[model samples]
Target: MSAPPSGPSLPKPESITASLLLGAMFNWALWGVLGCQTYLYHIYFPNDKAAFKYLIYGVFLFETAQTALNTHDTYIWFSRGFGDFLNFTKVLTSPLNTPMMGAVIALVVQLFYAHRIWTLRKSWLWFCMLLVGITLAQTGGAFYGGIRAFQAGSFVKAQTDPSNRRAVYVWLIGEAVADVLIAAAMVYLMILRRGQSHRFRSHGILARVVTITVESNCATASLAILSLIMFAGIPDTNYFTCPTIVIGKVYANTLLVSFNNRIVLRNLSQIGSPSFSSGSNIVTSSRLPLQKSTPSSAGRAFESDTITYTVHRFTETDSTTEKMDHELQETSAMKGSPSHHV
Candidate 1:
């Protein structure tokens, strides 16, 4: 009789478990850094226009929750102690709670950005609307799918029936698509602002490049996670069990941390620039005139041409100074006093 056919080998559980744990730890660290940076930016330099600190906070929170869920799932698979309970907990907490919070944060950020663009009277409102619509659709789809998976108890069944794993795949893909759209919109906005600065050109370029790179890495990591979910469909006997999921989580978290750091550094540099003081003064003066215009009808009528004049005199003696002041007044009156348009 022919020798019995050799059975397919199972992956070493210890190796896979170790990698997943390490990945989760790294992700947690990254999330902590991101959160800290957000707090710093919001507190120290609240007036920085380029800083959207909340984006980092939202992404960090979601990724941290995701890493926790994955780590728990991997632990349960290897340890086999209360595996069903842990799996159910992850399902209920991650795709439903975490993603919903992230979606809301992202929507608010997009709306704020849209308002900023509208204030500038730019023509990119339609493009922003399209991007926001797609992002909302993807987030909503993923959120609903996650809720269904939790309700159906598919996380417990993933170890047995591979067909029930479609929910995970759908969630991953939806998130990836949303991330890509957001990144694209951000990059486009940066490009639009490229030509408007001279003193801060390098900073703008670096910020835009870093933002694009981080978003691209995030999208790539999401795709990698989706690929790992596909591998989960394979039979346990023949599964190779690579560290793809852990690596994806680590990459995603790292990108978010880097993005936050860049934003903080950029804001600090802007605060130290000379233009900041001048710009603030100009803004203050502009608002003052607008506020004072409503005090009287004459003020309103003169608002368009109300000019403030200043005279400067330099002399070695008081007599010469007085003479110079008189000459300056005569010159001003002869020229009809150049008026400023408010």
Candidate 2:
């Protein structure tokens, strides 16, 4: 194990000022976004699974707490100036907001996706189980690393030890693996579902659904990969942290979008054209409760159902009933009865 030098010191030499500023800004912006997205999800997708709702609420609340903690730390660092911003021991971010929490959030999101996969394709159980195992592995490693790192309170020391480095490495690499597996599995499930169901194939509903899935997971997975690479490549610098800080939020918010986008996908399918041109155009949504879409020019299927009428013929209709009704003006309607006086 490597030990840090004696006596406390400030982080003037390290250029982590940008990291702190950027991380804070990203956290704040994502939190604002998360609020709006949560509102829309509840309002529009009210019929989502109860478990899913609880998961969202849990994440929302937990992340809200995290946001508060992060903000408070930033405030103390900037306003109070009691400790150096770069000095891990002087700063008090640990035990409050750790990457382990992020790991848990990411794990929950993975489990959500795993459930989705199970529902989509039971045959994919083994794969989903693998993902769940990976999630747990990462969570364990991250929790250990975060607690240790926080306690050690020294970035230099944290990276110097093989065990410390191994813990974080396991956590980050596991997270990246989870991302890749989940995304690819989801895409595969969607494609398989459409192929199995002919109706879905003709309407291209699943096509759009696949497109959305790919779009949503692609950004997140790319970030995960990038973060993992940076963490691996540049273990000492704060560069890896730039992505690590916001990645959990990204995972949570992305899961939120994926959950809520189900309703959007259903609505879009109902109003979609029959013909679909995939990859040629993009369906964009603004960052808000409502994301507008430009109508696709694909050909639409117009179903016209015809109702047939039945006609009955009577024999000797004219001869049997020459006059169905007779006028009663003469008051001699019956052959043997006379009409009563009014």
Show where candidate 1 strays beyond 4 Å: 1-23, 46-121, 154-170, 190-192, 196-342
Candidate 2 weakest lDDT stretch, 10 residues: 332-341
Deviation (Å) of 127 in candidate 2: 1.2
Please provide, for model 2 over 1-342, each residue's C-alpha lDDT reduced to its tens digit, 9 standing for 90 to 100: 889768965454344455655777898898888888899777865655676678888888888888888788667656676455454324367333657768888888778777766766778789889988998998888888877777777666666767767888788888877777776875665555554544432335455555655666676677767867776776555566667677778877887776565544433432433332223332222233333344343432222233221222334344322221111112111111111111
lDDT, candidate 2, at 238 = 58
For candidate 2, the clash count comes to 0
TM-score top scorer: 2
* Global CA lDDT computed for model 2: 0.63
Give the Cα error of residue 268 in candidate 1, in Å.
Answer: 8.5
Q: Mind giving the per-residue lDDT tens digits that candidate 1 earns over 1-342?
A: 999999966455543344435544554565565566556545644443444444554555665665566556555654654434233223334334334444444444444444444443357667666656755664564466556656656433433444334544444454455456545655655566555544453444345444644465465546545544544655442121233333333444444444334333333334423332222121111212432233343222223234432222222465643543343333222111121111
Instruction: For candidate 2, list the clashing residue pairs, or say none.
Output: none
**Model 2 misplaced stretches (Cα beyond 4 Å):** 1-14, 82-91, 200-203, 271-342
Model 1 TM-score, all chains together = 0.48
TM-score of each: 0.48, 0.71
Cα deviation at 68, candidate 1, in Å, is 7.6
